[model samples]
Target chain A: MKFIVEDAGAYLQIKVTEARIDAAIATPFKDKLREIVVKHRKPVHLDMANVTFMDSSGLGAMIAVRKSLPDNLAIVLCAMTPNVERVFRLTRMDRVFDIRPDAIQKEANE
Target chain B: MRLKAVVPPKTQPMFHRVLDADPVVVRATLTDMRHRFARDVCDDTLGRLELVMAELMNNVAEHAPVATSDRLPVIHLCIVRHQAGLACALADDGVSLPDACMLPRSLPPAIADNLPEGGFGWFLVQNLTQALCYYRASSRNYLAFNIPFMEREDENLS
Candidate 1:
């Protein structure tokens, strides 16, 4: 349930440190991330590079976080590993969220 | 007496484990299972196998019959590699699996406002597996399925 959060002014950049988001930690992971997003009141840029595995419970947690936010606010998932991405693709949750291959580099581009 | 000729192990890899029905235990078993067959299978097929196993095992853990005895259900898992795919068999002393789980299924509707947070586990299992079958006998539930290798254009070349 570890995450590195950075305030990027307009959005919160979160890097998930855990290697696997499975049934063991999905509930707490959802609760902690939800609290972080609710407190910031801004868009989210989730860096998922370290998550090598994610089960349906983990996917459920991600969906719960998405549902927690207001419609105007967005959560952009980034740098998904192949295993994590497979669950989303197989279950069609890929259509629900915006997933990127790399972490947001809004500052570097500017 | 004549010296015995040396014999080699079986050509295909196999894995077996018996453990309590718990999420942490299931995760550890899956990790070990992946390492056991990682060299034998391609990434796509292995990924599919892992996902299906996780979904099945976790479903058992999540739905442990609470009103029964306080002991946790025990699960026996066995996997064997074949030329066509990986064959997986799991038996658990948990509650009988719901009939709906084994039937053909579809994903929950993707409603825009109220998105589905659950109900995707069995759907993924059914989608990724082949020849899936289940039966309950003598207070134990048994499930068996095959995860076929993904078709590759270059397969014939190799």
Candidate 2:
């Protein structure tokens, strides 16, 4: 997995690429986000604008990222695909996050 | 990491799980996979392999063209050390390797936006693993990969 960092004023936008995030690779991905949290400590706009599939491993990684925040940072999930969105809804985690319906390609460019 | 302990010390340090290739089991499978890894690999290390395997199994079960048998697909997992990395494999008794070019070229917008919900599984599987290979001999499919290996207690992403 690879991350593209974008400074979006108050929130740092993290564009995720290579899609699937799960157990086999969660450590590095989680560590990168933790690095961001410690270094940036601002509202995070997780531009899922580019990610397609996410299993529980991916969800767990995101939750890990959330837990690593400075306690005041907000995470906004934009452009969640049906499957990925379904995971959040099923896990009742959608309620824990600010999930917005953003177009896949359109939102990423923004 | 030299694991020479021959006895079951007070702490059981490993977890193994097997699940049917049903969609309902995806969440539980992931939860189980994470709990197993949480003791070792931290969130910052790498998290795609587990996701990749789950996606691969889901794709085999849900997307691959169903044969006349319509038998449920099987997924087998085994964890071992390869040098300084963790080696894992997810094998199935369904379809063969797909066109490499047709692999999900880009990470889609979100799971919800994938209108037909068909291609995301392959897209997801290919993206998660560090090294990926598909074997079609012996009338089955074997998918495998590896990730950096680390011991337990150091995995707090926080």
Candidate 3:
């Protein structure tokens, strides 16, 4: 999995470049996220535009990341595909994060 | 009435099919599970698949020695309608229930079955699936499990 961080002024944009997020990939995925926070601690506007699938491990990693962030820092998940959204809804996590499916290109217009 | 030729009941059960034990197989298995057991399964079915798939795939990856590059394990599936429920089977050519798995365990058993310990998978197989059964064939192992399949009659008939 790969992560791209772009400066968004108020909130940092973290884009995940991976097809699947499951047990096989959770280790490195979490490690990298932790590293990103240590270096660039701030509110994250996560863009999961490329993530096709996510499992419990991935969700665990995401929640862990959410809890570890600096206080007052917010995390927003944007561009969740149908499959990813299903997972969030099943776990009732959609209520926990600010989730939206607007495309990355739409970000500029808004 | 002319008697129709008697056919054998399907030994393979209902809608069950065999597929190769590869990473890509998870997609198909999960798809089938979702379609056939829609009510019994919830959105978390994908996570269940992830946990089961990880253990099975790891069994093959950890134990299946390759004298030949093409000798990966085979996974067989069978779906059966139990008394008041439904179940599926996943058979493989990997070693039979890791010997350490069938023994008495010290942990909570269900959640910690996949820890790094050699037999952690046994714990998972036993707990994740509703009813877990194990048997070893000549050169293969079979796991049969059954879980509750919710029904409209559950409330009305009860």
Candidate 4:
């Protein structure tokens, strides 16, 4: 799984570059995100614009990442493709994390 | 029962494959199917099919019993273009879900501190398909469902 990490002032933005996030990449993705979270100690804004597909494993990985974070630090997901967003909604993860329709604009406005 | 009867006779010919229960093979098969049927179905339906297949095949790869030989266990997948949508049937000679691991009717509670890391596979599959059925017969697990050729806008995130 490829990710482009950016250190925004308020949050650490990580853009996932893969088209599909499944069981194959779930573990590595979670581990990488955990490392970044621990190092930055800032709120994470995951950019899912490039991800066209996500399965339950992918959803679980995101949740695992959230669980691993400090209570004060938040992980926000943004710009999810329709399909990826569906998985989140179906699993009700939308309620668990802060999901933004457009993270770029949200970040810019912040 | 003949597998051809899964879809009506007037529909397109069925696409079938027997693949090793491996994640890489599952990914390749779905990619090939997407390309082959790109022109035949809408993007939404195709995407749903892809998600469902990924969940099912990956489940097999992860939890299914492995063969003792050098080769791994196998799964049979058959798909056909139906009048309403696409019909799919998958069979695998793997261990069935234990009594405690049956499919859930509702989504798990979304708690940030204690979020669940698994158990979302069959839930998504059930939510995305119609007339879903699962049963074990003759030491094989059979799963069949239909994906309608329409976009699912019911759970919009906006």
The alpha-carbon deviation from the true structure for residue B82 of candidate 2, after best TM-score superposition, in angstroms, is: 5.0
Candidate 3 lDDT tens digits, B81-128: 444445667778865566666554433222222222123344444544
| Descending-DockQ candidate ranking | 1, 4, 3, 2
Please give, for residues B1-158, the per-residue lDDT of candidate 2 as tens digits.
99886965343334455666665565467667766766556553335545555666666656445566666666666654344456777666666766762354543344331222223445544444457666677867776676654564234322
Per-residue lDDT over B1-158 for candidate 1, one digit per residue giving the tens place of the 0 to 100 score? 99899887557789999988999999999999999987778878888898898889888899999887798899999999876788899999999998999888999998988899899999999999999999999999999999988776125222
* iRMSD in angstroms, per model: 0.8, 10.4, 7.8, 0.9
TM-score of model 1 (CA atoms): 0.93
TM-score of the second chain, each candidate in turn, equals 0.89, 0.64, 0.60, 0.80
Candidate 2 has a TM-score of 0.47
Better of 1 and 3 by DockQ: 1
Q: Which CAPRI level is candidate 3?
A: incorrect
Candidate that beats the other on TM-score, 1 or 4, i.e. the better one: 1
Best by DockQ: 1
**Candidate 1, DockQ to 2 decimals?**
0.83
Candidate 3 residue pairs in backbone clash: B113-B120
Count of clashes, each model = 0, 28, 1, 0
Minimum summed lDDT over a 10-residue window in model 1 chain A is located at: A101-110
Q: What share of the true interface contacts does candidate 3 keep?
A: 0.00
